[model samples]
Target chain A: MSTTNNHEPILSFKDVTFAYEPHVPATLKDVSFELPKDSFTVIVGPSGSGKSTILRLVTGLDKAQKGSVQNTARTRMIFQGGALLPWETTLNNVKVGFTGRKMSEAQKTHDAMAALTELGIDTLGDSYPRHLSGGQRQRVGIARALVSSPELLLLDEPFSALDIETSKRLSDEVLRIHSEQHITMLMVSHSVEDAVMLADRILVFKDGHIAEEIPVSLPRPRTITDPEVQAIIKHVQGTIPSSG
Target chain B: MKVTHTELQAKPRMTTHYWSHRGRRAHRTNLLHRIGSGLVLPIALVLVTGFLATGVALVPSRISAEAGTLLAALGASFLRLFIAYVFSLVIGVALGLLAERGRRLESALLPIFDVLESMPVLAFFPVVIILFLKANLLEGAAVFIIFFSMVWNIAFSVVGGVRQTPEDVKAVGVVFGMTWKERLFKILLPSVFPAILTGSILAVADGWNIVIVAEALRAYAPQSDKAHDLFGIGSILVHASSTGDSTTLLAAMGILVVAIALVNIALWQPLLAYAERFKFE
Candidate 1:
């Protein structure tokens, strides 16, 4: 809502249709969307509703079957499971995403340490991922994604596996990052509350299409009890199509 | 009376400290195991090295009915097994990785490997003789046979490991733009290490069993016995049994037992313990 009248989209998926297998029905049928700069958007849907498929396609992990996916912004994705390498320590894990690029070890180590430090995990840099807690591992995941200073951050149910307290803390951190760094954030979340808390706009998916795009024009630091936010949440809940 | 949420959480937090204490006990146990294994391996190594030295000192002809020749024969047999083991390891890793190329290939390879692995070593004799004997690799026929027995364990386990990699991990590879080299060295191999270690233990066991015929099959190759039969522990055992050389047979068999036991204690067990950290939770 704070975005200016910027006509250009940082990333766009025009008429995108995708399927995991050739024999299966299309998961996303002619879906289209353009994300504005420095905005937080959440895709809300039931399972197999193409919510995660959209996230994957954005990261080029799963290409669209028939459509144009034009991305001008440098992008990174944080996973649901944190996905840290079991062998590598926290610092080395931060360095994993920067594979094959031309950079000195010293520079990379410095950058990785700085990113870990930013995430409040610099002291645990030498510890292997197996030794870290779930929350700590996800923090490492965020550090890894942010190491390259990507313009757009894609989150694939990043807090689904976490407990409520950890989830809320991470949500706050994400909001801070979005506001302070001015990075475009697109998240796929099943929780209506999560969608309400962080998203500037919620794209409610039905079957294989985005059924409704609900906008939240509330000010920063919103709460569930806010009258306007409650109205938006109620609207979003009603807009979601019932699954069989 | 209602318990506070923090009060409830405190129970598990306290147990975490208890678990840490248990972890310290485990570390102490692990250190003891290390010391025990350390002592066993060097003694075993020194014995093996002594045999190796004896074999080096003596010519090929001197390997005979004497108990003195048993240590040297054990060394030669152990060497053949080791060489075969190394070959199997490389081939198995390659086959496992190759199977991961596509789903179709993977499906096809599983059944083929199953059939190949299930077939008895003796059953494959004609094919082995044809391939290895004609190739003139050595009593080297044993190496090939041992390789076959061992490679399957590794290949199958590696494929399984690759299959079990978490979806999120694979997604990370793509989102981060991981090169093939990085994926293999960092993610693939490290993740698959526990599997590889497990496979290797079985492979070495298989290698031990096959090394017998592998060294003794020289006569079947239509070469003269003295010229072709390699002076390995397997051959020594076979030769002693046939000729009723009881002293040499017992000594050679003893060496074999000690070698296997020592390797399990010193190498595989420790490696398995180390690889526990590599597995994806």
Candidate 2:
């Protein structure tokens, strides 16, 4: 695995509290965490446990009602739904990621193809979103996010929308990306198996707060069948509070 | 020995996966060719419109005096519709943006727009004429009426577009760090486009239907016939009907039908097809 060995914090949420409105109950309360550069962190919890909300906060789509959210790294998100612009071809949709950049149109197209090539999806460039399968669309979403060469990547339930086989395949590819590029990732997911497979750190959330923050130091190429991987998964599951 | 994440990355991105997506796009392109005989409609439209534009240029010089009068009336009516549609588009986009500014404003404005829009084309005309004639604005009476006909639906469509914008698309704007200007132009406007297209198509159809009644403003202000100068398809048809001039009436009817057809085929249909890309399927 490529090692950056940079221990600087890229993102921090300090005593942050968030709510959709005054009447609505808080989605998060007194949440605090730090994401160091070049690590893969996964937030895992139940449906309303504020996992996805944390990702949104990182992306600045929702401001914390109290405290502060500070980040030094440029970030991009791979949304749960892919969020591919329906009007554009896969290549064109990926190109929008470079909207503010000074790249020429030809360069945008070239870089977009290169990103797709990295995701193993260059052949799907000319196709529109409607023409693509769920797996293909998610790969396109990843390509769009990676094209910016962002220091941070946010993924909100990236595999919740995919099937079993596709999810496993995508999860492995994401693991490869982390091992190869060392881009800091903050992902929210429902899959404990995915957390064990990919994350360098696993954060268990309950009632809008972090219940446990566990560092994962398993060797590269860890599998669920491995005892250490299963032990981490079991530990994370137990750390999560009951749904009631 | 289990294949791990690193080994998986070495797996070839299978060619079979490309067949459905890449293949489908190629199939659709081929299908478009098959349906329209190699996409000749555009080439044909350019050739036809070019020839007509040239013929139109030589109207007074080459055409008969009677035909020229018909063409002139057609041009006048078409010009009014064009101007009115332009006004409608500007007002529609402006009002749409305004309506989205707040929930209270939308709640206040939407019902008012609905009530006015649902009223018949004639309901607003008499009031508008009274005001225009009182202000000595008889020349603009028809154009104003057409604007009213076209603006409401387009405005509502804009409102709907903003309200129904997908959450993920909004997140896209936030994540990409798009500025307010970029978000409005690139993301927000494009998200609202299919609705705008739908509204505009209906509004133009409504505009054409009402232009006839609108141009009969001369009936209300007979004393100002020379001042009003309401020369158009509506006026010609009105005159031909009252005089029982069968030949002129048939010619006017024929040209009106042809004009609406050409516009639908050339402009709206192509745009509607292009809008399929924004479906978010």
Candidate 3:
């Protein structure tokens, strides 16, 4: 047991190992990482590389069979396909994130609207998730997560369903929001390019272990065309073995 | 693709002008046409009901009073049906929830419910009558018969609905930190609403089907008399049919049909439409 201190990482996984079934091979084996306060990190790997398992562990959705997961920050997750309540309008969906809070209905509504406003989708508050386009749905997802004012935002391939153009635009919007809010963000993506563009630090997973950890010290608003960014992307891509 | 600057510029203005002018007029016409179309069903229902009422009124003098008597009987039957339906719904949902609480419970109880559901309610009427007679609860006995006929469908439907609740929806409840009570009312209940409604429709139909048998059981009453007999549409229909009074029987049957149609239109249809909003994509 360690004492709480300013120097401690906001989230830490110490030799964590997990499996869906006891007899099967572990999905995450002896996985360890630390996310410092207010850092933007991306976990990148190929499909079935256990990137999402790591996320599940961090969000406390799943438990590690061995070792320990220490998370101090209050966390909110944006699931793939947005996972917005189909029965609720965007405002109501966002308001649902504040369900356990001791707040008035008016306060919840105002906070939800404010979160949507921050994402520039306040006008869509009355629209249901089915009525919104993919990008719009993800924006509502972000607003839902942000309304809770969590210290850490976990994104599980939030933009995987969008077109490339929409994905890039949303990536920029997420980056801007990250900068403005100064909230710690940990995103799981299969796209190395997305990792290079958005993350301050990238953890590449392979065969249930961290293959490499790359630091992106490049200036803001990075592009794939940049030589340094391309080099890092290439390096990260090279770390994952091809299935064939 | 290539487009001339003039063509591109002119296309937008022409399209907007043409659409805006035609849109408002078309929208108004569509609205009025929709309203007219919507009124057709209700108008036809009213006309049919009126025709039936007139036919019943013009029946022979021997059964001239039968129409009014049948209507009163229908009202009485409806009251019993309502009570039985409400009782069944509460018990069914509670049992369904208990069954869904765990695999062992579901396995143990679901088969019993299935067997009880398959057995005809009439088979148990003798037992019900004897029990209620001993307790001096004849009305309770009749309602219990109807409740038995209707409850199984609702309970099974609820079990299916609970099982079919999507994994992601349940995950959302957990992630959002909803208490068990909140999860039950807010998530589980709303998620299963369509199933409950579907079951209710079937249960109501079953209730109507069994009401005649249930109310006409006065023939088996211990001290058979008008006082012992339940006065409802079922009892009147049975009496009319037994006496070979075709006019009274026909009028009573017509009244029952009209009553069912009215309840379907006024109650079930609107409820079904309202429940549609709770269904997940």
Candidate 4:
């Protein structure tokens, strides 16, 4: 595991509130949290608990109705279902991240290829999203996010569509990337196990509020069967209200 | 496992192999074969038209003269249809973009368009003729009628395309920091290209269906005569049929059929194939 200094906050939500419809109650009400730089933080909660909304807020894809979202990092979002452009090849999809940048076409291609190669998908650069497996597509999505070298990477249920083994493999790959790059990583997931296994810090959300913030100080390469990891997972799961 | 240079080299060769196999299969039904097969019917129709025009095989001299006149009329009709179709395409796509921009615009415009589209185009002919005649644009009146007949299908198709745009794709654009203009041109337009192509095909067919009626309106116009009337296949066919000139009528119909067939073969087929690249699936 790579060491990270938690002295600096890369992003923070200060009493943020938002609503999709004027007649409805706010989806996120007085949500406040700080994400430390170079930390892997996961926001876990039940469905419609506004964990995903927080990710969108951090990425600036949604605006807060009240209060403020403060961030000091260049950010990119990894959406659910990969969200790779179907018409673009893997390389081209990643290359899109370089849009508006001052780079030559060849330099953009080279950087895109490098990003894909890092994700173990360099050979699939020419393959369209429709032609790739779900896992492969997600890797391309990661490459697209990573090619820009964002200081903050936000992922919203990115591995929920994959099987357990594939999800574990990708989770491990994400850990490796996070440790190697020391980027601030914020992920939102409904899976307690994923939060326990992958996150350095877990923020539990309930009813649009941060119910608890749990820090996993365990050693690297923690397994699901580990007592401490399982204990944290069980605790997080118990905190979330069961659906009737 | 770490990837090596050798593995990278080998991967592209595999891609090449896969594509080469696809290319070989495509080579069997290459461009030459496609063009040759497409031309067969049009070529046969041309030969028959030529035979009739030359008064060969018992065709009367008067019938031959009518056929020559009908061919010129067909050319005139096609020119008008082409102009009308181009104008409709631009207006339809522009209106579609406007309608797609927001719910308020769509609600305000789509119902009006729906009503206009369903009304009999001939009902608007008098209005069109008067408007254009006052402007001294007789050809413009005919073109406008055909344009009205064709524009609605394309506009509706564009609306459908915009509505069906994938949510994920839009999110991708947003996350990537693409400007509104870039998103419109690079993503939105390409995503709707297949829809546009489908709409254009329907519009062209609609144009063909109405072009005859639009041109035939010339027969009812004041001071209309063979020498001064609108010169078009529809006008010629109407005149020949009314005068009991069966040979001229047959030739006019034959020429129109051949022209439509040739356009479908030479233009629409290739365009449809190209547009398949833009389809999401």
Candidate 5:
């Protein structure tokens, strides 16, 4: 969430293209972008516009078949689904995201707890993800991504499954965490309002290309109703099709 | 007025009664309930057929008491088998992980495991007897038989489990910078719990049958003894058949059947349930 000019770019995708099958066209077509270090960038697009694919590429889930993707910072991805190991508790799910770190068990648990605490669901640590509400599950996903102290966090529609009220609350919580942790975040979202509210720069992906990059330049502690956010929302709405 | 109040109470009570009866109907019609109920007819038929063919009336004497004894025997064997099973699991899972993680190594080694699995373990009797004789190792034959029954399943299951791990989950592990050891214990093992348990249970069941051959035949038993010295259920059945002691034969067979059934019910089912609980949708 740091939008200041002093930091370097933490990640870059230069003309990267990828496809599941060689015969099919690339899902992402020569897409390029830079994530300014410690800043929040949201990639908004119609469904199947390759926003999720970009996040996947950055996180190394799918390798870029063409062009290059360079990540200067250590990257961890929060899948759109919580992806909690079915057998583990919420705390353990968060802990899974930090496996093999040289930190002591105590430190790992402590860090996981702190992340959960930041999201205001510390008491639910012992509860399994199966028992949690959708919003709570997403919180576990976020805690998991952050617990690793990742330098770059990729969120693939992490809040899309929740109710609007819960999504807004979680968004605010995520923004607070971003400000506190100073982690660079690249989130894939469908909501223009979400992109405008949370991003330092909103990159609209269309037909696998970044059709627009609308810099919010809005003040910190902004809301959906902010004039600058509404203007960016309008601009993104204009550039991208209403239906995917 | 008092009578009217009593009638009102009785009306509510009758409605409660009606709902309770309706609840039973609902439960009985449920899919799980139907499956549970359907199990009764087939099992009863099998039991009746098996019992009638044995020609031994279900007597309250030793015949009934032997069921308890058979249960105890099964319990003891289960403990021993469990120990072997655990050892097999560790070794199998380790090798499985190796095979999965190292494709080239797996290709080189897998054919051997395949050969081992396909080779009828019964064929190894003479070789085991000869080896035990040469090595002056008592019980070596039994150990060989048990090991033969166990190793392949463990290895196969472990490999399957490791191979079946979802790509997304593995990617998560890599992103977290998990060491090889961490990946094996934390990610691979839990992910393959169902497969491992399934394989191990099958191996254990297979071991029971093989143990009968190893114990009853006693390839090196004295020629004059006529196999009567053997203490296993198979030996008992063999003796009973030759002597026309049909009741004893059926009793022994009953014990074996019961042992196998108890294992499937008490042990394998629970293991399967536990493993399944870990399985991701």
Candidate 6:
């Protein structure tokens, strides 16, 4: 809805397929997508439906054996569990992605603090990961990913473990980050409301293939009550089974 | 009467705080109770042992039989062990990191450590002597034996610690952009602190057992024709077996047990306490 000029794809996954084990048939098969620049895309699917596989392949965490993926090399992933290193303070954890790199310690600390401060967690710089609340930890997760100034940010159900309110708050934070940083975001979220509220496009995966790509033409700072967003949500709900 | 949404949320939040406070209080009480209970056992032992030693002749028969000499031997052995422990810890940590990072190398080298652990230290006494003789590393020979006895446990424990690292934690490291060294130092080492301490405690025990044998075995001087008497539990056992000294042998056995107990309390207990401060999340 933003622009019909779809000539350039920031990331292209051409017929990618992957499996967890050799004996098993592919968890994802012939999955293909072209993500445009600075787009907030959400992939929703049932469990074992290759939503995570897509994220992993895009982030280069796991390679696809069957097909090729072309994307920016500097892709940072935010794991579902907010896997902040337990030993690190919030700032140090953010800086861990830059340790021993060309950046000076002072610069690393400053950059890490800037990221945390942007997420409204600057006071938690010295606090260890164990000390933070669930929402706080997710904020740290976002900070860690953003601190690297990555070209592409991959989010793997980063709010699934949180309460509904916390999840919404985190989603708002993520939206703020996307708008501010302008990083291409590909998130895997199961919540229909989450997909509605944040994503520019919602991708529905079924049986290892992207079954549907629904575009939201809703206005910025989108809320759940927007009629267009609700209709799209209803459409996505109808397309996917209720159990998912 | 409808409760506000904030009021509804406040109830669970307040309850959580209340429960966590209660849990903290219970934990503190439990710790105090355990400490109190542990003191009783040590006090009762002191009473019983004092009663047993009453009116027994405290004459110094051999150097080890004398309390002063036994104390000195314990101190020297402890010093040797401390040196060995420091070296093993450094080497084990380095090797463990390498082994964890290098899977192929780990598979190759880990079996050798397993075999070394399986081989009893006593079985290698002759080998240690022969090797020390050929190498001519005089001052550090006893320490070498101590180090050898302790190294494998630390290495294996560290290896296990690395392997047992939760996938969630590793993912966190990757997401955060931790370098190999930062991951090893901050993520890996702190995560494995308990295992390292557990292995260290076992290693200290093993090294203590081997020290007496090492000193006694090395006390033999062939050319001088007068063996410098090695004074330890092993020496006591040797003398008792040779001359049919039952009471003294029992006394020596008691001494060895006490020595082991003291070392466990003084050395390993503190380390264990320190390690336990950092619980697994």
RMSD of each: 7.4, 8.5, 8.1, 5.9, 9.3, 6.9
Q: Best candidate, DockQ-wise?
A: 4
What does chain B score (TM) in every candidate?
Answer: 0.74, 0.72, 0.77, 0.76, 0.72, 0.68
Off by over 4 Å in 4: A1-8, B1-72, B219-229
Residue-level lDDT of model 3, residues B1-281, one tens digit each, is: 11111222332222111111111111222423433443445545544664564454444676565567777889999999999999989998888888998778988998999899999888788788889989998899899999999998789889988887766566666677778888788788887776787787789889988888778766666556655668898887787777776566666766676777566545654555555456565
RMSD of 2: 8.5
Give lDDT tens digits, candidate 5, residues A27-101. Answer: 888888888877899988888788888867776767998899987677787766676776788888898877656
Interface DockQ of each model: 0.37, 0.29, 0.32, 0.40, 0.29, 0.30
The stretch of ten residues in a row with the least summed lDDT in candidate 1 chain B is B15-24
Q: Among all windows of ten consecutive residues in candidate 2 chain A, which has the lowest summed lDDT? A: A1-10
Better of 4 and 5 by TM-score: 4
Tens digits of lDDT, candidate 2, A1-244:
2223377688989999998768888999899999888889999998898988887888887789899998888889998879888877789889878968888999999999988887777777777777677888898899899888888889888898999998888888888887787789999888888887888899999989988899999987787799889888888888877776
DockQ score of the complex predicted as candidate 2: 0.29
Q: How much lDDT does candidate 1 score? A: 0.77
- Which candidate would rank higher by DockQ, 2 or 4? 4
lDDT per model, in order?
0.77, 0.78, 0.78, 0.78, 0.70, 0.70
The runs of at least 3 residues in candidate 2 whose Cα sits more than 4 Å from the true structure, single-residue gaps closed, are A1-8, A239-244, B1-67, B101-112, B115-121, B130-136, B219-229, B242-250
Which is better, 4 or 5, measured by DockQ? Answer: 4
Q: What's the candidate order when arranged by decreasing TM-score?
A: 1, 4, 2, 3, 6, 5
Off by over 4 Å in 3: A1-6, A14-31, A44-67, A203-217, A234-244, B1-64, B97-113, B218-229
Cα displacement (angstroms), candidate 5, residue B264, comes to 4.8
Cα error, residue A132 of model 3, in Å, equals 1.8
lDDT of 1 by residue, A59-107 (tens): 8877888998988887898988799988777888999756656899999
Q: Which residues of candidate 6, in runs, are more than 4 Å off?
A: A1-8, A20-24, A100-107, A225-227, A238-244, B1-68, B94-116, B136-145, B175-178, B218-279
**Which candidate's TM-score is highest?**
1
The CAPRI category of model 6 is: acceptable
